[model samples]
Target chain A: AQTVTQSQPEMSVQEAETVTLSCTYDTSESDYYLFWYKQPPSRQMILVIRQEAYKQQNATENRFSVNFQKAAKSFSLKISDSQLGDAAMYFCAYQKGATSGTYKYIFGTGTRLKVLA
Target chain B: GAGVSQSPRYKVAKRGQDVALRCDPISGHVSLFWYQQALGQGPEFLTYFQNEAQLDKSGLPSDRFFAERPEGSVSTLKIQRTQQEDSAVYLCASSRRVDQPQHFGDGTRLSIL
Candidate 1:
């Protein structure tokens, strides 16, 4: 079984500052995918970013980027220029493709992020 | 649909009652997923469907929980004899293919009283 862990339960950042949410996972499969999902107060799950294990380059989407260290089993999310809208529960997820037998995302406990004015 | 759609955003049920949550995936999507989100916790995978075939349901907490995607589009999760522990947000997501990113719906919040 694969497990994802988000050590930080809560985090806060000043407006326009940067914040990083840490995550780690335990997986024996070499072929897998990592993701960051944001759930706002609306309770809508939104995709923040993703990283393929085979890719050495980190993934970045505007203010959101990921530091994926496959060897260390670390996949942390970095949010730059944080705004009030960025306040949400962030989760790290791991998934093995169909080739690995089945598909289901294993998620971390989540880290509540607050953007202070 | 514009994205995954889950009907009956909020549902309140008495203990021992049964409840059904519906999910409509995006058109042409081949993969659908179900998750449960408890308060102050991240969403946990419950089941997965590849079109009409349910490939993985190991994440389902118990035998009382059942999910099906008969036509390869819309899916439903049924909980029998709901309990207070069953109170949580049921989220549905869909992906274009096996390797694609899964888009999610607002989720159905179930409250068992």
Candidate 2:
């Protein structure tokens, strides 16, 4: 079974600064996908970014990017120039490859992020 | 809809009562999923549907929980004799295909009193 672990229970970052959220996972499958999702008070989960296991290059989406170290099974999210709106609960997720014939997402406990002024 | 839509933004039901949560996936999404998220916790997979067929239900916690997608678009998760432990936010997600990224709904907050 694949499990995702988010070590930080809560994190704080000053507005206009940068912060990184750590995430690690354990999986036997070589092919899979990793994702970061942000849930605001509204309770809607918004996809931040995603990384494919086979892709050596990390995934970057504007101010959001991921440091995907496949060998170490570590996928971390880096938020640059954080804003007050960045405050939310972030979750890391894992999914098997397309050919695995599975469509369930394994999510981590989540890390609450607070952007300080 | 443009994204996943869940009905009854909030639901309050007494213990032993039955509750049904609805989910409307994207217009043409082929894969839909249901997840249960407790307070201050991440969402946990409850079931999965591919079109009109429920392909995986291994994550369902007990026999009291049931979900279905008869027309491959609108889905419902029904809980029989709801318990206090069943109180949580039920989220629904959908993707265009099995390999695509999923779009999540705002979720239905179910409270048991």
Candidate 3:
């Protein structure tokens, strides 16, 4: 069984500042994928960033980036230049590799981000 | 629609009543998924479908819950004799392929009174 853990239940960041949301997972499979998703009040989940377990280089999407440590099983999202719009619920997810024959996502409890102006 | 679309943004059903939620995936998406999210909790996988074939339904809570995607593009999740415990937001997602990133819909909030 794969389980994702988001340690921070809530976080606050001043506008234009940077913030990091921590995430860790436990999975026996060596090949897998990690993801960070944001859900605003509208209730639609938007993909923020993604990282492949085999890729040593972290994944970065514009202002968002991830610190993916395969050995420690830690994948954290760092939001640079945080704005008010960045306030939302962030969730970390895990998925098995393509050859694993399954496409289910295991999600963490989520961390509520509050961007202060 | 350009993205996955779920119908009846909100639903209120009395206990013991039956309810159905609809999900329309992307035009050419080959894989669809259904998830249940309780208040203040992360979404949990409920079922998965490849084309019109339901490949995995292990996450469904009970026999009262049923889903079908006969035509492959449109899917529906039906709950019979709804209970208070079943109240939650039902989300739908789709991807170009099983290995692709999933695009999620706004979700349908179901409430059982």
Candidate 4:
């Protein structure tokens, strides 16, 4: 079974600053997907960004980006020019490739991020 | 609607009672999923549906939990003999295809008293 780990339980960043959330996983499969999800106080889980294990180029979405290190089993999310809207509970999730019979997404405990104005 | 929709944004049920949560996925989506999110924890997979077929349900905690998508669009997750441990947010998501990125609903907060 694959499991995701988010070492940081809580984090805070000042407005317009940058912050990175750590994430690691254990899996035997070489090809898979890693995703970062943001859950606001509204209880809406939104996908921040995603990265494919086979792609060496990191995934970047607007101010949200990811540093995916397949060999190190680490996938960290970086938020640049952070705004107050970035405050939320961030989760790291892992999912197997299409070939896998059951594509169940495994999520980590999560990290609460606070953006200070 | 433009996104996945879940009904009864909040639900409260007494211990040993039964409760049902509804989810209406985006039109034409081929995949639907249900997840349970405990406070301060990440959402955990509960079950999945491919159109009208239930391909996976191993993540369900127990047999007391049942889910179905009869028309392949709307889904229902029913819990029998609810317990305090079952209190959590139930999230519903849908994807264009099995391998596509899924969009989640606001989720229904279930409270067992």
Candidate 5:
């Protein structure tokens, strides 16, 4: 079975500071994708960033970046210059590619981030 | 017309009541997915559909939980004789193609009483 783990149950960050949330997964598949998703109080799940396993380079989007270690099966999310608006439950997910290159994802437990003023 | 959309944003049902949750995938999307998220946990994959065919249903907790997409567009997740453990946020998502990014709907919050 494929499983993703986010060890941090809760994280606190002062506004403007940076934070890193760690994630590790157990999978035998070599070709896959990684993603970070944010769910705020509004109850909507939004994609934050994504990275393909074949690519060694990490994935980043403005304030969000990922440290994806394929060998270790680790994918950590970095939130830079965090703001109050960034407070939310952050999930790290893994997707194994299919025969046609499409894939289904498995998500980590999640890390609740609280951006304190 | 835009992002994925789910109906009955909130639902409350008794233990034996039957409930149906609807999902409208993005237009032209070829892959649709359903996930069950318990309180304070990441969403767990429940099923996957490519067009009208149900490709994967391994994530469904039990036989009581069922899902279908007859036309490969709109999908419905039905739960029979709901249990207290079934209470959770059911999420629906879709992608234009298998490798494309998935767009998600806000989801339906189902609370079992």
Candidate 6:
């Protein structure tokens, strides 16, 4: 079974600063994918970024980037130029390639990030 | 118009009652998934469907939690004898392909009283 772990329960950052949330996952499969998802007060699950196991380069989306260390099973999210709107709960997830046309995702508990004014 | 949709945005049910949550995936999407998200937590997978066939349901916490996707497009999650612990936001997602990034719906908030 694969499991994602987010050690930080809560984090805070000043406006215009940068914040990083740590994530780690355990998986025996060699082929899989990792992702970061953000959920605001609206309770919508929004994709933040993704990293493929086969890719060596980290994935970035605007101010959101990931530090993926496959060897350590570590995948972390970095948010630069943090804004007040960035306050939300961030979750890390892992999934294996589909088998029989279906796949299940393992998700972390989540880290609540607050952007201070 | 292309995003996933979940009906009955919020539902309140008395304990021990039955409830059903619906999800409509994006058009042409071949994969649909059901996840449970408690307040202040990440979503947890409950089941997966490739069209009409339910291929994986190992993450379902109990036998009372059942999900079905008929015709490979629309899906439903049914909880029998709902308990207070079952109160949470139920999320649905779909992807174009197995490994593609999944698009999610706002979710159905289920409150068990």
DockQ of each: 0.84, 0.91, 0.91, 0.85, 0.71, 0.78
A9-110 per-residue lDDT for model 3 (tens digits): 999999999999999999999989999999999999999998989999999999999998888999999999999999999999999998998899999999
TM-score of chain A of each: 0.98, 0.99, 0.99, 0.98, 0.94, 0.96
Error of 2 at B90 (Å): 0.2
Provide the TM-score for each candidate, comma-separated.
Answer: 0.98, 0.99, 0.99, 0.98, 0.96, 0.95
Clashing pairs in 2: none
Candidate 6, residues A1-117: lDDT per residue as tens digits? Answer: 688999999999999999999999998888888999898888878899989898999999999999999899999999999999899999898988654244777889999999999
Q: Give the TM-score of candidate 5.
A: 0.96
Task: Name the better of 3 and 4 by TM-score.
Answer: 3
lDDT of 4 by residue, A6-95 (tens): 999999999999999999999999879899999999998899998988899999999999998888999999999999999999999998
Which scores higher on TM-score, 1 or 6? 1
Candidate 4 TM-score to native: 0.98
> On residues B1-113, what C-alpha lDDT tens digit does candidate 2 reach at each position?
77899999999999999999999999999999999999988899999999999999998999999999998989999999999999999999999999999999999999999
Candidate 6 or 2, higher lDDT: 2
Segments in model 3 whose C-alpha atoms lie over 4 Å from true places = none
Candidate structures ordered by TM-score, highest first: 3, 2, 4, 1, 5, 6
Q: Interface RMSD for each candidate model?
A: 1.1, 0.6, 0.5, 0.8, 1.6, 1.4
Q: Is candidate 3 or candidate 5 better by lDDT?
A: 3
Candidate 1 clashing pairs?
none
Give a tens-digit lDDT track for model 1, residues B32-59: 9999999988888899999899999988
Cα lDDT of model 5 by residue, A1-117, tens digit: 788999999999999999999999998888788889999977788999999989999998998999988888899999999999999998888888755343667888899999999
What is the lDDT for B101 in model 4? 79
Local accuracy of candidate 2 as per-residue lDDT tens digits, A30-67: 99999999999999999999999999999999999999
Considering chain A alone, what is the TM-score of candidate 5? 0.94
lDDT: which is higher, 1 or 6? Answer: 1
